[model samples]
Target: MQTVNLGIVAHVDAGKTSLTERLLHATGVIDRLGSVDAGTTQTDTGEIERRRGITIRSAVVSFTVRDRQVNLLDTPGHSDFVAEVERALGVLDAAVLVLSAVEGVQPHSRRIMRVLRSLGLPTLIFVNKIDRAGARVDELVADVRRLLTPTVVPLGTVRAPGTPGASYRPHPRGYDQRLAEVLAEHDDDVLAALVDDLPLDGDRVDEALRAQVAAGQVHPLLFGSALSGAGVPELLDAVAALLPPSPPAESDPRARVFAIERDPSGERVAYLRAYGGQFRTRERVTAYRREPDGRTTATRGRITRLDVVGAATDRAALTAGHIARVVGLTGVRLGDQLGSPAGLDGRSHFPAPTLEAVVRPREASRTLALHAALLDIADTDPFLRTRVAPDGGTSVLLYGEVQREVLSSTLVETYGIEAEFGPGRLMHVERPTGTGTAVEIIGHGFFGTVGFRVEPGDGVDYRREVELGSLPLSFHTAIEEAARAALDQGCHGWPVTDIRITLTHSGYWSPITTAGHFRDLAPYVLMQALAEAGTRVFEPCRRFDVEVPADRLGPVTSYLSRLGARLDGTAAVPAGWRIAGVLPARLELEAQRRLPDLSSGEGLWSSTPGGDRPVSGEPPRRARTDGNPFDRVAYLRFLAQPPSRPVAVRDAGPERGHRSPR
Candidate 1:
């Protein structure tokens, strides 16, 4: 049977979930259709998600379309959960991008399209909710062509759009001049044939259209109302007819872990999208992960249990193009490559969280429990980063308030602990302004000497001037790992980025030199170098798009200006004034909150992540989690303290709580 891993993606409230429900019902996977408003959707089974009427986690379900097996992954639509979407993107064979007829092309819609195009994933556009009030089928289609790609060919037309009588009629499957014209833009043969007025073969045109769609160069647009079940069958037919299937599995086994969840008994269950070979029950697999230094680490684990999609038994083999729920790979994490990393790129598809909020327990006594729960959540969603302060206060990195709210609710519901979150703030990073070097020798009760030279560069580049054969690989790995972890909190307490660090010196007593010694001393030496280099702090920024009544443009622009927005461009639109600019991420929420009032509730505001810039004024400070290594006296004492003593080093990266090797 053929297989395709499909994803349904869209902006929030664009009816993605509703469409999922419609597809499931149409496929006879479920007898009764679930409603998003009532919180009864199959994919949205969490209590909190159902109550909120949104998808917090990506859900997977399998159904057959004739001889093809379709594993449909319904992903979160809200921007707060875009990391979920990012994870899903890596495992997909193709995607269905949903858009609302009334809302037309939204900011997130454009964002999703950009990612899909970048990945070259074949996509089909579903313009949903055609039977709703204010639906503009023609205008929305035109806008999709203008704002999105002009390579889209409408598969059908909607009759009586924006009314109860709305219906879809697919264009006849024949030689179409419009389809040929769209294809001609990319195909010289088609263009020549059209120009020469030669006979066009429908079979040839169909084959060319299929090839282009599979290449992601052309998109097909279909109009439907998911709520009314119109045009759904056509969409389903397109999935089987137009989109390509996953390639056959290779003899070598490989799978990418995309989603993770805990079973009812709290055992970790990872959803794997297999690319080659097969995963069997009780089989051992090696998991490979790429580190910050661009080095790959490997660990082995046995699969205690396995559940293959569309299989009749739990022990069935999970082959390529299928998804499975596997347990007992305790060290396996989201993005881990099982068996091999051959076909997967370890780069992140989405931007990191630019906002963070301090999470505090209401009773103050459950701080430890709150922190533990948060760590578990972070393990599931790697982008939802958690930090611990010296005072035991915990903060979580986030994309926006929705993530914070969901976190708060999850803490209360899952862990039975009430928590409060502080106001969100911009997450800043530091970069070294100059070059500086520091070295710690073996005489100070430690058996090793490690040196690092810090300089500005792109990403966390680590190199070595010392000979590779000078020390054991274990010791070298320890130094590289410690160096990367130290940069997690730089001189100003922000994660230092875009810097190059080179190991310039290394010396240790042969028998007495333990990897732990290098690990312990590397941070102190690196921090000293960063301080001498004088790091600069940079704050995140966002590009904003605003539309308001022509009469309210002055007030809206004035308010935005007061909030420190740099208006890069402006134009007059039929609805109002369209403004584009860059705004500090710290003030984005405030600007969004006040836009409606400024425009008398007729304003439309949207923003996308823009690269950060250095702060112009005095830089803000964050609570230091790493021992104050810049202060020689305090750091020496910190290192001298006994292992049993309570200390401020609660923010250890990756290896947190593990005793240092002696």
Candidate 2:
């Protein structure tokens, strides 16, 4: 049998979870239907998810449908937990976009559709809640066509009378009038058949639709009520009959681990999508994981367990186009590429970690333990980054206030570690303002000394140049790697970015000063170089895409002005105007908060962090620290660190009231 990885996605309360439940029960994957309201759904196994009645993590369940074994991913609909959705998208062969017939196309759904298009995944539109009163399928389709894809066509007749226990047949008039034109536009053969005939044969239509869908030029629209089990069987049949099977995983041996989980016994489980060869249990694998140095390494681990998702049996081997759980990989992380990576980057456009907060244990004695635990949590959720302070306090990056609350609760209930986070703040980075050069020397019998010139970059390159007299060619890699690590954090507390470090001169004694010594001392030397180079603050900016009516362009531009946005340009869109620009990320939130009112409920907006922009209105201030590289006393104080303490945590509810520590 063929394999398919289908993702069911939607805006909150659009019946995405409900659709999953109906599909599972309808396909006999489960005996009874579970309810999201009742908190009894099979895939939402997390305690918090069950109680909150929302999916926080993407979960999988498998079923055989239409002659294919399909692994269905139920993704989180809440925009706050969108990272979860993005992770699942990386493994999807195709997607089912769930939209409400009554509520129509929502903002989050449109945002998701944008990403789906960018990834070029075949998509099927399921207009759910057809049985609901006041549902307007035509209006919903129009919104979908206007905002998402214009080529979306209705696949089968909805609400038409047919023989009981038989398949849904397309209404000849609807098919000839709407879908036929769409198919004809895409395939000359289909157009020939349509012109030469009256009504399209179902098989011919299915073949043409599948071809276009796979090409991502057309998306089939199906209508249904997942709750009433109305039109669900047709949706299932459409997926099985119209969608293409995934590319075989056995073609390559590489797999990407998109998520990580812990079993009840605390054994780590990694959710992997085999892009290539088969994975056998007890096989020693060469794993490649992205490191802090921004490179992948050969971290070897043995796979001790292999189980198909939602299946009871443990399989000795798993192949491509399959999602499975494996254990005993000690060094794997959320985006690690297993089995040589085979030219896979394993990096997606993950949302930047913008919110920063200080964390400490409620008990002062567990300071070091608390710090370690925070890093552990960050490893699981890459969006969360940890910063350790000299005072034994730790800080973390977060998405929003609710995420902060969720992290606090998880720390307490899951890890048995209670912690409180300071109020989250916008994370800002720093960069050098002017060019400068500095030198570090090893006296007497020591091996070598290094000199570097640091300067601001034009945003295209951040590199290290080796000038003449740079030790042996083999030693350059060690020095380059060390210099990059040192540049990670600049003169200010913020991370350093967009700067070029050139090796102006090198004096080395090859015998004593090994690569290890150069690697160890390069950071200290680089720090001094950056300090002499001088530094300035840069705030995070977001790139915005907005669409509104032509008449509403004035109000939109007016709103952007208030948000301190620099308008890149605007173009004519079918609905109205398409505006693009860069704006302060802080104001991006403000824009989100007030968009409905500004757009009068008819506008669409999306944004992603666009990296750092220099302080425009005000003279930029420098990041402050007590023992920074510029301060020699503090630099010496850094050498004697680490007298740990136990920590204490207080329950700060969903809305964190504190600010990140200075």
Candidate 3:
């Protein structure tokens, strides 16, 4: 049987999880359909997700259709969970992007579509909730074409007889019209045959459409009401007929590490997608680590187990064109690829974390435990990056609030360690604005002095990259370490951004200066130099998508203007107005609270941090009230009083309310 890995993505409330359950039931993988409203969806297994009636993480499940195995990855739709969707995309062969017939294309949907295009993955569009009233299929399709991609063409339509709030059934004629359009676009010959009014065969049309889809030239759009199971069988048939199978290969040894997890037995498992080559059990493979020196070293590890999809037992050897779990390798980090000859570069192209928070254990004794638990979680999800601040605080980089909550829950449940989180913060680095000199003096007559210039670099978003070399390796390492430490405690206790530093020449003691001594003193000297040279703070900004009722549009625009946000654009959604804009991070919380109030609870907004910008404008002014008349009168009398005159020599000795001069 052929196997295909596909992902289902959509905006929140677009019926993604519900559609997933319907697909499962239609394929006989499940006995009954699970509902997201009831918190019983099979894919949303986490307690937090079930309770909230939303998917927090990506869930993978396997089922069969038309004698072909289909592995489905159900991903979260909320923008906060974008990292989950990104991770799921890395291993998917293709994607099914679901859209609401009434809502059309939303901000989240557009974002995911951009991601899909970036990855160069073929996609299918599922227009769900067509049974709802006022569901304009033609209008939604047009909006999708304008916003998402023009390649998405409807395969069939669903006709329902009702008003905006009535139940309806799918009309067969509408479905046939859509199918004919799809078939006509599949190939030139098919189009000609359809135009000539000649009979077309279903099997031939399916084959042609599958070929077009696999080539990424077109996306077949289908409509379905996952609730009523309308057109579900046709959707399943498309999944089996249109999705491409994995190409066969013989031991080419190229695989991507899509995810990392820990088994019940506590062993780390790296989920791998082998595009080519057979990975045999007990075979030694070389792994390479990316290092700063540009030298990669190969380490060998034996694969103890190889488990593949549809395998009945553990004895089966995993081959190419399969998602498999390989174990028995230690020292392998998440996102690291394993292969022969050991020097091949295997890296996961995931986005950097957007938000960060500091984590510390409630009990000091559990610090080590908390650290270990965080590392494990980070391993499982490469999107979470952990760094230790110079002040001994642990900082965790997260995607958003949902990830923050998940980390908190994992800490409490998995490790039995209680921890507290500081406010979400942005990471900034210090760069030089101009050339400056710094001097480091070691204990007992050892000194190192260096001349460096900090300036702007090529990267527009980052503060700047530090470029310095030609000095002794020991001294250079110390200087780099010092620069990093200086950044941790920025000039005014805030992180620095968008600046670069270059190290020129340095003077060092030949006999007495040591690396350790320089390392200890370099940071202080760097801090002093930065203070003398001057540095500025940078703040993060976000790209916000705000939706409000048409009547509340004026209030929404006014609120955004007051918050110092810039309007990108606006569009008319099904039941509301969508305003896209950018706002500073400091104003995000306030905007979130005020938007709903301004729109009378009819407005909704989502935002993602959009890099840092140079700090601008002066701080806000303080307010003061008028003083009382008594205080004013006292002030006037004090001002009118003459200054005390100098006393004579004899009188200077002592006086009432006066000091004596000797």
Better of 2 and 3 by lDDT: 2
Sorted by TM-score (best first), the order is 1, 2, 3
Q: Poorest 10 consecutive residues of model 1 by lDDT?
A: 653-662
Candidate 3 local Cα displacement, residue 41, angstroms? 5.6
Task: Point to the candidate with the largest TM-score.
Answer: 1
List where candidate 2 sits over 4 angstroms from the true fold.
157-175, 190-204, 250-252, 310-314, 431-436, 444-448, 454-482, 502-520, 531-536, 542-556, 567-582, 588-612, 618-626, 643-662
Please provide, for model 2 over 339-362, each residue's C-alpha lDDT reduced to its tens digit, 9 standing for 90 to 100: 866645545555566777788899
The alpha-carbon deviation from the true structure for residue 614 of candidate 2, after best TM-score superposition, in angstroms, is 3.2
* Cα lDDT of model 3 by residue, 378-398, tens digit: 766656767553233467887
Please give each candidate's TM-score: 0.92, 0.84, 0.73
How does model 3 fare in lDDT?
0.66
lDDT of 2: 0.74
